[model samples]
Target chain A: MSQPSHSSVLPQTELTRHRRLREQGSFRRADLDAILDAGFVCHLGVIVEGRPLVVPTVYGRDERVLYVHGSVASRSMAGGTPVCVTVTQVDGLVLARSVFEHGVNYRSAVIHGTVRKVTDPDEKLEGLRRLTEHATPGQWSYARQPNRKELAATTLLALSLEEASVKIRTGAPDDGDGPDADLGVWAGTLPLTATWGAPEPDPLLPPDIPVPAHIARREGTRHG
Target chain B: MSQPSHSSVLPQTELTRHRRLREQGSFRRADLDAILDAGFVCHLGVIVEGRPLVVPTVYGRDERVLYVHGSVASRSMAGGTPVCVTVTQVDGLVLARSVFEHGVNYRSAVIHGTVRKVTDPDEKLEGLRRLTEHATPGQWSYARQPNRKELAATTLLALSLEEASVKIRTGAPDDGDGPDADLGVWAGTLPLTATWGAPEPDPLLPPDIPVPAHIARREGTRHG
Candidate 1:
């Protein structure tokens, strides 16, 4: 077997061991990276002044760390604090005949680490570029870079993905072994999906700017 | 004008305020309810043993409080615990010409409150019904309720929506007024939407089991 890369981006947590519903949890490093790359937003959980905070923030990732940005004054990102970031995509609703067996099929990752403030000018610029491209591919090269003043007002933090785990659930609910099997009730999953809709151009466009192929082709495609 | 009901949930701390882009912050009570009603899954943020934990859990709502449940063995539903619940829906992407101005147009509601264990037998039954309907509308009344043994192994918590805030952002990006506009870069919102697709019946479902109107009509509808 090929050895896994010992990168900080890889999940290396003890609790990450697949337990209850063992088949649902995976240890593939590629799985975590793929999920993070396909998604742009995450809920960053942190204790701010001793209060638990789970704020949704835009994020990007390099090979080693996940970067999240906010306003310089954001209480959630200020002071180079420690935080736990979780990115989740609900794949489907596991509907069982019995309420006790009802569950959801999902893909989720939880990262635990300190979000050190990215103060170096070069890293900050690169961080912003990663964030922009993460949201809309090729948009970074298309748009003007932020000036010094804008950069100064922004706060970016890089959190290692080392202490993380990926938990996934799929297929139907496990209602077979229980008495629920004979309940005469309907049981299965309603596959929940997120897809890209038709691209609506800016109303004020000179009417000459054609939609980029990358953006246009994404229309109606399933995301995550 | 008739005064709106103060039944609106209120924001408690500065951290909960719409600080970065104050204009997007919505204080209207209806906004809170609408966001909550539009979502069935919420990320519950709580501290366990001084370490923060963020768990995505399904929730049901009534006139005054939200109910969450899980296996009685779930560490997430410990009673008398303080937790913050957040429900977010990403409606669109604000893809401004300038990367600094790009953002996600989203509607999110955050509730900060303590979770109380429900002991009353009747309320537990009602809570289970609400949760069932929350996941699969019309199925609660159609399916068999949980038996006594199942109830003994389930945990339920009630969290008041008394202290909460709704934050929303919509429309195009704020790149129209900057020097970035002179770069002649395309700028506008790339709307992202989530909708329900055609319902696929359970393969094991009897071929004669006609899809109920409530479930069937949800085909191609927007998810709440």
Candidate 2:
């Protein structure tokens, strides 16, 4: 009945803490930052017109500010709204013999904060740069810069990353405690993995040009 | 000044749809269903006291009802509050020489609806079944059913899937029209994938038992 506290330690947070699988839930700051930095797109959760809205968008980050962009009239970018943004990456499947025990090996970050619309010209320019470069490390310098009209047409919101938590699940299933153990189920982790593949050349590419070494060598590597 | 409508044309449900990269957005009801059916854990987006909350949760589904369970005190399942539930699977990565053209191969489902607290005994039991079966295909039959006390302590919300949309991106990079095309920049999709690994037996399991065939056969196959 009292005012709802948005603090990270709200009573509800205590409930979500790893109950059966304690190691999977983390309160560490670095863990949350790492998971968020490795991903570019996030599901932006907000309330519009008393209804919840979860819109996916590209995100850019500075040390403390997380920037998200959309069209000027986009519902997600409505000024002064409180929003929660989440980034998640699934690393593998934690397969168990008993279906009840199956789980996933994943890393996820959830940030809760109030979003403020950016209006200053310099801050807007810098925000777009961060967004572009966040997606591709060297992209801001390589591409054409946004013009005055382009900047005006875009909408950007900056939210502080001070209130957030990281929840991660790694390793195998937890079916060891029951009588079902003797059920003769072959149970072990069949690790699921994802890695970058070779970059293909565009078909219309001119014959003489060659691939850049940095981009070419990045193939077959882990992305985040 | 009036409240902006969040609903869009059949395909443009999410904000990403209006971007220049329209091809990256998709709308198919079946795709949404399949992605949700395949996944167990979901990032639940909710609003509490005008602020947004994205909490990772385990969900189950019947034909129209998507049941979400939480502790009775969870802010996410507050009675009558609106919520958005999203389930996504990133299948592959799209790597283009030009960073602007880079993208990902993914299947994602977004359900936008109001929450109806499940109070009926029949629906509640059925919801629990769907939830357990969703995690493990045959799990409901194998495990002890939830007792009345457990049901009373648990909070379940049934949300309609009627206002949902599926957005999918697949295949190669979209760098065919840019100047980078002539630069011979490597432009192809680095296929991303997820599959089941060998299952690890519970440490306490007796030495004689073997794994079940239904789960055993899923080894190395893609799972939600």
Which has the greatest DockQ? 1
For this target, which candidate reaches the highest TM-score against the unseen true structure? 1
lDDT of each: 0.73, 0.66
* Candidate 1 structure quality by residue, lDDT tens digits, A29-88: 777887788688888777766667677788998877888976312555555566777788
Clashes of 2: 24
Q: Which regions in candidate 1 have their CA more than 4 angstroms from the true location?
A: A1-4, A7-21, A71-80, B1-6, B9-15, B71-79, B202-206
Clashing pairs in 1: B38-B224
Q: Weakest 10 consecutive residues, lDDT, candidate 1 chain B?
A: B1-10
lDDT per residue, candidate 2, B68-129, as tens digits?
86622154465667777888776654556554455556777778777888878778888878
Indicate the worst ten consecutive residues by lDDT in candidate 1 chain A.
A1-10
The i-RMS of candidate 1 is 2.4
Error of 1 at A138 (Å): 1.4
The positional error of residue A76 in candidate 2, measured at the CA in angstroms, is 4.3
Model 1 interface CAPRI class: medium
